[model samples]
Target chain A: MTGPVLTVRDRGGQRVATLSLGGLARRAGIVGAALVVDLAVLSSAPGTPWWPGIVVLTLALVAAEVPDSQAPLLTLAVAAGWWLAAVPWPAPSPGRVLLVALALLVLHATTAVAAIGPPGRVAEARVVRAAAGRAALVGTGTTGIGALALAADGRVVVPGAVGVALLAVAGLAWAATRPTRQ
Target chain B: MSGWHPTHAHLRAVVAGFGLLVAGLVLGRVDAIVLATPLLLVALAGAQSRPSVVPVLEGPQGALAVHEGEDVVWSATISGLPAGGSVAALHPGQRWLEVEPETGQVVAADDGLATTSIGLRPTRWGWRTLGAPAVTGYDAWAAWRWVADRPQPLRLTVLPSTEQPDTTAPAPHPYGLVGQERAVRLGEGTELAKVRPFEPGDRLRRIHWPTSARTGTLHVTATHADEDAHVVLLLDAVNDVGSSGGLVGERSSMDLAVRAAAVLAEHFLRRGDRVGLRVFGDWRVSFLPSSSGRHQLRRLLNVLSVVEPGTARGEDALAARQGLGAGTLAILLSPLVEPASTQQVAMLTSAGIEVIVVDTLPAELVTGDRGRSPEEQLAWRLRMLQRRLERDRMASLGIPVVTWTGPHSIDKVLRDLARRSATPRLVRR
Candidate 1:
């Protein structure tokens, strides 16, 4: 009478997440391709360091190869690597920063798709496609905003009032995005 | 059912975005803020899109009854799932219950409803509990998951496949009102019994004009009455030898006995015979009096489905023998594991019950015992030898012991029993 409920626990101790050699290779290829793009864009910036790019690449690869449970940590590491790469006094160009952000998004999306289910199970094509499509939409919007910021003639003044306003907006965004528990 | 919880994917994005934003503001880095802005936007969008209503799962329900190897679709419908997409994963509780394409993805329609199905095939016969498969619903972004709470475990009753028996058994004794069997006492039937002088109560329709004219007297045709027979199936559940691998694996002695009993019961019941059952094992002896009809067959099979091998008790065997009715054809289906069952058969034959011993022991047991030590093997061989001697004793006493071989397994034995039933035999007072 009752409908089937999805449980997190694996019955019969069955391994739900499995990584096949071919599946691993396919995931590795996606991570490798993303890394190449990230490195290429970061190197275009005049003062970008090589170590940060290498660190991001390593984290991205690990995220793609590990299980879903551990992939989030690696994803966080990749973000931290990006932050390290942007630490120089004279920041990278807005265009290059935008490109690096897009690359990181692609890596995160791909890793999420590859690692979500029972072990060794190949994710459905539709799921991967949806994730990619969403990432692309968000990336396009970010690119447009970055281009506009670069076009502005003078530095925007951060008055205390404006700073307070921006902080409030960020706070609102955080509150709106917080996950709700049943 | 567990409540909604944030997935690691969502948590990672939120933590990384906030960490970068705080670090950028503290360190006076404009590029870092720009970099963190996109991730924060994504996290915000995912969080705001989370629907207030959780999906109400409707089923994994389909056929609760099926034959071995038959496939049944287990499906669940979610009515309140937000329009976008979700993933549903089904995990079967038992190995014998196999699910095809274990997991499924569903996209909700404009009405916010999605239905998903998985094919399940049960590989064995019995009343088996199809463990409650946990169905977890994941959001499109794989950010949030909710587990539905199901109240009861799903149950599947797998019936054994009925093997079509190619041979028929002649009724040893028929005593019912109407049936297919030819009765000894003449009354009214299709088969002619004899022609005799017409009696006062004889109907005019039964008169034979030619016989009346030749004999110079009124003569009427007499025929035999058709009566149904009572068949008693005695199943030995004292012990199960060898390993049972469901439908695909090697059948244990208990499996053989149950399947064979089902086949015989179906055959006789379809022929208008009243069939009964008696099972003796560790538990008390269970008995069902002879009855005829399709419902009776169901009752017989239901009883068989719950049968399990138990410790042998000599008194249970004797108690099972007491349930046998006079003039019934009692078919003893057993592996002959215990000497008490052998004695039970000897008693049934001596009581003029007309018994047939169907040897339900798997042939693999003789060679399969190789896994044991040499001394244990010797003991098994000696026990088998004694079993062989018991069978020989039954054969000498005019009881036919047949080994089940599917289709025509009992044809020869039944044919011989038919021949023996025609001759006069002494009846115990």
Candidate 2:
């Protein structure tokens, strides 16, 4: 559904602008930005099955083009990525790992957006954002720890670790402020 | 009670985010994938959410009487809660509405329960019904999502605008039986009669004491003849306010006519006069005519309240009034908006009934907006002239037209009516 909103009109012919497409685009962008941060953390972590987690993250980020339920799908993808990273795989280049992280943010945003129709549930955005924000916090923490380990080994993968934490925190904040379903 | 609201845009956002997450996962961006993944899921849940709304309505006989400019309160009791959340009811109308979240009258039960009382004032009159209502809420903790369908609706009947009465004057002559009109001989009234003078057993009051004393004979005075009057109300619907082409509200000449008719009917009934009504407008739109009793008044008011935009269709013509024979004082309530309506009233006057025309039309059908060009001003003046001519024509036909140009109390018509009514005396020649 486009999400539902009540509208009122008067004799003067004034109409209220309820759920508009512009809001949808913004939500998608928010989820997209958050996914980008999350992917960075997963990339820098060591001893993680890089491919599967990278693959899921790629899906989430790319799907964020729509930015609706992509957060949930993105979360699943991130979980899968983590599981895959736990398995053994060929050593990947830093640049390639970064690309996978960015992909996750894109996928989540785009895929979730595909589900929206009309009646514009502008209120739901907040709830979804809040929930996504909490999950983002956890993901960011894991990214930070991974970055610290790399730093101790003189690897110093600050870019990936910091990006994940910041994006997660941002997503959480956006979600918390939005008016979503109770 | 409980519901979720998932916007399509939110879902679209999820889909977009999901696509981005997928790409990030394929690219080996673990942190980005994890962050984007949660957002995708959240968007999905929100997308799936449905927002539901319910509204409670109550009043005497299930109908509420809301005065003009007075707020009519609509109370909605909400239940079914999500964690860490509150409910909000929003109506996007210009009518300023006051919403009270918690009040003494509101009772709450369960995890989340709140009542929203909204107040609205009607600036004008007529019928109005509430559209679909929307209710939305979120978790207190700001997690998960919920939405429900809300179709709460209420119908409102806003009564017309009216002003309170100022210093009042008693009616000159009471028209009804209770007021003054009493009855007499061989007939249909309520007054008592008397016994005449007697040769032997006559009472003192009946003896005509002065006449007996002077003439050595007794003669008694007898009483007869005083009763209620019957009135027939005739409405000229041929010329309407809309046809006049003035300011939308002022142009509603028909509204004025109908309102006048209603007042007349009410006043006559109160005074115990038998009142019958006839409409010259398109009665097919829903017309009930010529009846008596309390029920008839209700039917008349119902017709008056139910007004729709219409034209002076040829359905009710002046010639059709030929059936009104005589003695029935025909009161024609009209705006004289059109020349045709004027001609109709003239014909009525020529026919025999003492016809009174309550002309409610303002000569200026339109006064153009400010800063108009000379050409525009000329056009407005021409329209005004046309209306003036129509009024003059009707007056020239010997019809007593009471031109009601206001800022005047609409009650003037009712007051004048009660005064003019007198007992009808039939003389057999």
Residue-level lDDT tens digits of model 1 in B1-429: 555666676666666666666666676665555566666667666675666667777885533777777888777776665555564555554766766555433333235666666678887677887767556666666666666776245678887767777665666788788777777889778889999999999999999999999989999999998888888999888888877777777788888888888888888888898999988873644787789999999888877876767854554455756756677889999998789888888778778888989898898885456346899888888888888988998888888888876757887777776677779888664
lDDT of 2 at B268: 52
lDDT of 2 by residue, A1-182 (tens): 22333445455434433434544554455455445545544554564444654554455444433334334554544543453444223224434333433334344333333333222333334434543464465345434543443234334334564466447446644553455333
Enumerate the chain B TM-scores of all models. Answer: 0.89, 0.61
- What are the DockQ scores of the candidates, in order? 0.27, 0.07
Best by lDDT, which number? 1
Instruction: Report the C-alpha lDDT of model 2 over B81-198, residue by residue, as the tens digit.
Output: 5433444444433332222211111122234565545555555444565544554444332223343455446665654333323413223232334322343332333344653555
Task: Identify the leading candidate in terms of DockQ.
Answer: 1
Query: Native-contact fraction for each model?
Result: 0.21, 0.04
DockQ, model 2, C-alpha based: 0.07
Model 1 in CAPRI terms: which quality? acceptable
